[model samples]
Target: MSDELQHLKAAMESMRGELDAMKAALSRLSRVVCIDKDDDGVETVHIECTDLLVRPWSDPRHLGVHIGSSEEGSYIKLYYHGEEHAAKPAISLAMHADGEPHIQLRGKDWKARTDICIQKDHGVVAVLGTNEARGAVMRAQPGGGSVAVLHPDGQARAVLVHSEQHQFPGSETARPSTDLIFANASHDTQMKLHTDDAGSLMMVGMAGHSDGVAVTMRKDGPAIIMRGVEDASSIHLMAAKDMARVAVNQGWLAGDKAAASLAAGGFGSSIELNECDGTKRVDISAMKDSASVQLLDAAGNDSVSLSHISGSHSSLAMRGVAEHDCIRIIANKDAALMRVTGPQDNDTDITSAVYEGKPHVLVRGRNRPLVMAGEAEHGGVVCAYGLKEVTGGVASLAGGPVSGVVSVSSQDGTPLMTLDGTDHGGRLLINNDLGLQRVVLGTKDEAGFLALNNTGSNGVIACATPEGGVVSVCDPDGNVIHTMPRLKDDDDDDD
Candidate 1:
């Protein structure tokens, strides 16, 4: 499609023969001495002043194979037809000073090459190449049928007939390049799989399209994730198959910082979701002993919580958003509790709890003593009003005088009985369901007194100085039904 693509395509195609051709070229180059002219020319009938075997081409004495003698050594040399002929040898096989056979091909600066060689260790090697260094080289060892292909850089790009039993040798031993392509004899590309320099898979597919899809790795490993632009939304899914670990993280455009993330493998799994604030989160994870689901507030406080342990252990709780572990439901292997709180402020609540081998349901309000509706172990339903907690309710009837100033009100919230503040003794008034005062018992003038009333009348019978222990029971007509008077002085204890 473009110049770069064209180059890449060409490069890929060239790679197919790069190895084989290289080895063939080197094999030819190394076999350079076997020139056609070496065995050509006519031989002399007898030894004479003029050396024998001359090629009768171009000139009479020119281009002849001769036996020469010098103070240095007796060797055979080939000469070209020139003014200074016989000064160099096109091919020479001679004896070294060490008495070992030595061989040389081609004179200095002569650009001639051949393709066969016989040598030590490698018995015979055929080198194939073109120029001085012979680009595209191949060296074949006849003894082992081993052939090496070298790149221009002299690096062995490929080698065949490895010593390992002539097996395929495995591609794993192939130093494959991300750009390397292996094609059929026709050089038609069928596949190219590669990984980037960072070792992240650049691609894995056919015909350079890599499974008909192009891939790019960013940052890390073989994990596939589909993320929206700018990471505003994403779905992450990965599994470490070896460890059986699976994880997922997904978010929506309409959700909080974290919409949902689940990571659960054999060891454990957890999912978090719907966090309004970064801190407002719900997390459910498994533990070796139990599993817990906790919903926390912005302050990292658990406002709603639930936990269950394998062996008889479970709990559920709701608390002030600012507090933690203010349980609504906390249980053990056998039982649990539940609590409901005011939607806001967390001031009023109702709870059912198991305490000290008993179960209690407590109704509580803001700045008000709790009302407990429970049953004693051997008793029936017991109801009382006082301080109550998950542990249990206070052991008192109407609660002491400090709590004595309770209010009983009508359906309209009008006080039927108003008993106000009693840190030092307050009034206790009883009223009808219509909020009309029916009886009042309290301290007036620093003396204890009790007043009785009817539906429309006030003070039907009154105990003026109840400090002396006296009571007046009233009738509906506003008359004293009976009176119990103090028989003794104000000795207080002398009843």
Candidate 2:
């Protein structure tokens, strides 16, 4: 009977070992399944009936973790579905309280408890808690110290050797390394460029894992080499030596080398030339900023220049000059010459002389200079809204249209052309004691060609145009009291 009992115990032990082996096989195939917590605070990872029968849990409070690598290692996990209120935190992999939660990590030679909290400090892309969090997740090195971190956002942020600075893999490093990230500005994730003992260059954009570019300066030379791959698997290259000449979208490739190029603009559809050598040349249409040129005359006098000349419009033309050289500016087919002498002094004098508003031309009160409106002489100041007032006329303002109220008075200061005067037959003439009222038009209407009249007859010389041909002086009503010859013939010209 004793022998029978021992044999039974051994059988039970064998069964236990087989069950453990089955569990290990199943866990290797497990994946993290997200289950939405329902209104009743229950999180459920629904599975097929056949799956449940193989690895059944007590009630619904089982949350599973496949604790090993997808390729190898034993599996260990505990699941909670909501069967017990106290088991909620374990199932959710979260702490119920407002403070930090500690998780114990066990390794071959050491055990450590790490506090979990949200990671902030990283710009828009990195938040707290996720691998992408700024300073959250860490991995233990084989020798026992935490050495590297993989951001939940999918970036291998940093890797350290002992207590030394972490070497983040990037284009600037040696070959066989990749330190890159992608981000949408709206997403709370980002790829950060790091700088050690210098400044970090940060780039953020919406792109795929492979849809980015990496540019690096050649260790021994001033040139830069850029490599990139698009999400569609297309590849491209850009080589440059400086930022000033070859801008990367918005940033200029920063360097002092004689040449630069950018492999950018969506799969490097374009190349840019910044500074080039003695025999190098680039097309003018491609230059947006001032390109540096090494112009070597037989005398070796270098003068950097632009490919195109700019001006104000048809009425204005831009000109340049060497020392003691004359700059000829042609305005509306009218050319004006200026001899530039010095640096700052020449620029100011030449600019003013060439572009100054031709005031008192095109009529004194005209808002724009005739030069601006296609006149040769007057075009200088046509668009010069800011004109100073000289003596003997209404002071000009910094700008015009000059539509606001104007106080036109006698030279002796008696109000003549005032806002109160009605426009009579388009003439602002008031029948003042001096017989001189005024009509005012906008600067554009400085020609003053419209008319006005007080047609309501009140008997004290009501307003009328000479064209009416009735010279009868009448009372308020239709009664004519006196008559005068028709002022003038219809064909009579005022001029």
How close is every model to the real structure, measured as TM-score? 0.35, 0.20
Tell me the number of clashing residue pairs for each predicted model: 27, 41
lDDT of each: 0.54, 0.34
Give the per-residue lDDT of model 1 (tens digit) for 1-495.
699999998988899679678889867654542323335574434233323456637656555676654455556667655656544556765544544444445634564343334355353333434443432333334323444445544444434442322222553443322333333333344333344334433222333222322244434434544445344465545555332222233333324464666676676777776554334478888967889998777766677778888877777776655443344666775555787777653667778876666677777687444666655433434344444343232332233434533455433345656666455467777777667777877775656766766676544454555355566665666665555773344345555
Scored by lDDT, the top model is: 1
Whole-structure CA lDDT of model 1: 0.54
lDDT of 2 by residue, 56-116 (tens): 2554334344232222222333333343432222311233244332233322222222333
Worst 10 residues of 1 by lDDT: 159-168
**Model 2 quality (TM-score):** 0.20
Displacement of the residue 21 alpha carbon in candidate 1, Å? 48
